[model samples]
Target: MAPTRAVAATQMIEVDRLDRLLGAIYDGPTESPPWNTALQQMREALSAAHVTLMLRPPSSESHGVMINTGQVTSQGVESYETHFFALDPFVRLPEGEVVTAEELIGSQQWLKSAMYQEYLKPLDIRHLLGADIYTKEGIECRLRITRSDDAEAFSAEDKALVKLLLPHLKRSIRLHAKLDYLECDRQLFAGAVNRMLVGMVTFAQDGSILELNQEAQRILAEKDGIVRSGTGIALSSNHENRDLQRMIRQALTGGPVEEPVEGPSVVEAMSVTRPSGRAKLGIVVRTIPLGEFTGAKQRPAAAVFLRDPESSGTQPSQEVVRRLFGLTRMEAALALLLAEGLTLDEAAEKLNVRRNTARTHLRSIFCKTGVTRQTMLVRMLLNSVISLG
Candidate 1:
């Protein structure tokens, strides 16, 4: 084949591999292929013995995901991470640019370096093609493909292949980071909701249940007046059931007319009667506006907050209270006592502190929480989701 035709054929093959790698990277949040597997495939395509992706490169503390087809051992990788990374010359290369080891430090200089003598020589690593593909917020992601002592040096074609892959690798890393952040946020939100004393349930526009917090699950498990039926919840009383369904419809449809012409009258508080002469459950249904950024039609339209007045309130974690209010341990304890409906003097006695000291702590708590009165402070603390934990 002519040189141009050969180059075209090689380019076509690399493109096919790139497409496969891109597909794997984009496969849903939970389903992306492992970095090592993708790197290994690229290793084979580039005819290199080793491929490594270093995150936050040049920092000795930074780590790397490496795939080696040669004699690189786990201990060698550990040594590289623990020590040799500080001496890695390619890490300091210009961001978003691709270069070879020889280009960065000529063969003579690389061979003379202590890094090569003490580390690379032992692993039989000789040639390397690398690129700093991504850089942001002091973090740099570098890709390196290495050849062994007996293997041929990286040619222009090999460099071209890596250059072609740089942008995709950058994009895939960013996508993975974003998905990780979203997952973390979701877990935090779910955890906070699950720990709440108030039972909470979110519903779609059609009144189908979207999600229920742990408290809601517990309430439904009791099988009192309210129960879940298929995807939707049900109330025992025909009148109450109809009322709930109507309220849900109103909330979904942006509230009722003649009730309030103000902003949105999408809030309704009702008492749900239970069987066996049990106390009625208090329920507040409120519309959950689908924000502009959330354009999905299937998003939740309303949230129902259920409160069983007979049930004891869950104690707010002291550590959480301190963190939220920027209070000391003593102040947090005082706040919790007040939240439990204790008067300032009663709380002071309970905490074994002098009334004057308790008064001082209360003032500090007021300043930190931005609430002036004891009633307002108690109300704010009770309504906060932190108490759920």
Candidate 2:
């Protein structure tokens, strides 16, 4: 076969493999994919000192396949999994790019972490080689290989294996993201419909109801009275009205028509104290495009904003957390500083404590609140209260 034909055949074979991988991934619908065995097998497949996978872009914080034949983990694999993945410089790595561990540290990003001291030095993780399986939209999926103390950097064969497997990895990622997105969309739609105050009814120009919120149903029911059947608020009476229904007909006929809705009434309100005692009602219609909604119908959307002025009082002082957590006054002050996004060492200096001592107190604070990290503690504290002062 010609070189061009050979390349085409290779591309076709890879595409078929990718499709099969995606089909398998999508077929297993669990949120936490059962990749434990798969990862272990892949590490064995790729010849390296140690191999690992880092899922990227949205960052589920996984440090995948590990080969420890060289005694890489001293304490336990779980310890590394629990603590180190959060601080791993390997996860944020861009797609199609390779990294060396030394280069990672020399870049100055790793010096801020306790991880550098905790893992890298003790385990003797030397050279690192990794690649990102890039998506068209630039989301990176990290695949990594770690070299041990004795081993040189990854060899050419290792890189070739990664290149060979890139297509399969990319397909799994796309299917996983699609499932994730659809799930999120379902949740968001349910939440929005449940919370909306105004009675919403979306209709095709032909008068078919596409969607409605609960509140909208209630308001419509009030006008139409009790419904023994689903037909109570059926098609608009003006559907047959040539002039008025023309708008709905025109809308459903092609895509959309900008015309007013002629309902009996719609609730509108003005200040009760005004001399005129203004009462408003309308059958206002708005034009929409067919491309707006995901389905066949035109999308009619509205944002409902509600404010409860009564219970919007400020939170209790931060002193409460200080008292509860047994924090020193300075530590409590530092907690407030961290809640505002200050660093631990910055908080330490501001509170006049040594960094190590402040770190101890911070850990204690995290333990007391059931928070495992500074970021979590800061977020929780911010939600409840303000500065102690």
Candidate 3:
């Protein structure tokens, strides 16, 4: 009876350890450096001299991503990736199964291998436990844990712990990878929008600003026509403010009540007056399509696009335009000026060239672009993909 009670107590302790391990693994995706804390926790739990998560395995084409928590130096990691990665024998183990160096290659062979004699032996690491995780999302990563040469070999319990963690680790890695991809896409589109100098403002159902890009921040900071008003935005004129508010309400509530809704959204546009008397700000309001189960409280419900007529200096890169249209440097510059609403004479003066030289370049541009008129050439250049560069 006494022996059975002791065994039950040991099981309870193991359960508690497993719980802590599980917590770290699941929360790994939200960490700042994603999985750094979880890797550190794993190293402590396994009593490892070093633990490495190979998010990508090194190849001839790429160095790969690696996260380490232990006694290894950055130089040592670089050396392994550059030279010793190819010689490593304990890799490509049975997927989803925890394995040791001795189990994969005999202890004698492992010690005699070049990877050990040159790399592992220098680090004083002798014992190795590893697992390869292959997720359904086509992600493949490796977990490597090592102990010093003098330390005892990994126990059966250690192998079991890692085996239990493999599945959760795979899921967390998949989640982190998906989030990373989405963030990259968001940055790409946001950067393009900023390059176009378009001010974008998104709103919640309660009319609070949910997200505003860099250009939007600049426009609101100026406070010429549209300004940040408490949680929402306001126009300089009271009449325009009322109209803006009405448009916002319609966008939030799925468009005007009198119209038959054709789709999930509605579009409305108006020009807002400025107190500074520069130019009117063009405002476009549109509803964002809601998901079947999405709640609107703090989520993005509507978007406002603000275009300032006075902010006309922004245009596509000169080099990109030159390459895209196969134009000479002067031709590209002249086309850009024309796209900015400049007359041919004004463009030539800006370029410090004679009117005849500007006319010749314009003719060349028209010939290359297959446009017969100046207006068509200007429209074509404005609509080209050079702005995305």
Number of the top lDDT candidate:
3
Cα lDDT of model 3 by residue, 169-243, tens digit = 998999898988999999999998887778999999888899998888988999898889899999888999998
Residues 210-251, candidate 1: write the lDDT tens digits. Answer: 988888888888889999988888899999998887888888
Worst 10 residues of 3 by lDDT: 1-10
- In candidate 3, stretches whose alpha carbon ends up further than 4 angstroms from where it belongs are 1-17, 255-265, 295-297, 312-314
Please, what are the lDDT tens digits per residue for candidate 2 over residues 1-389? 44453254345345655454345434433534433334444455443556554454222466443423333454656666667667676655555545555465663555445565677656676556667676775555566666666866665445555555566667766766677789899667755444423344456544555665665555445433212124113222333223323433443444233444464222221111112222321222334444643574344422211111111223335577688667776667777778656799888888888999998888777776788988888778756534222
Best first by lDDT, ranked: 3, 1, 2
The weakest ten consecutive residues by lDDT in model 2 span: 302-311
Q: What is the C-alpha lDDT of each candidate?
A: 0.78, 0.52, 0.86
Which pairs clash inside model 3? none
TM value for model 1? 0.68
Return whichever of 1 and 3 wins on lDDT. 3
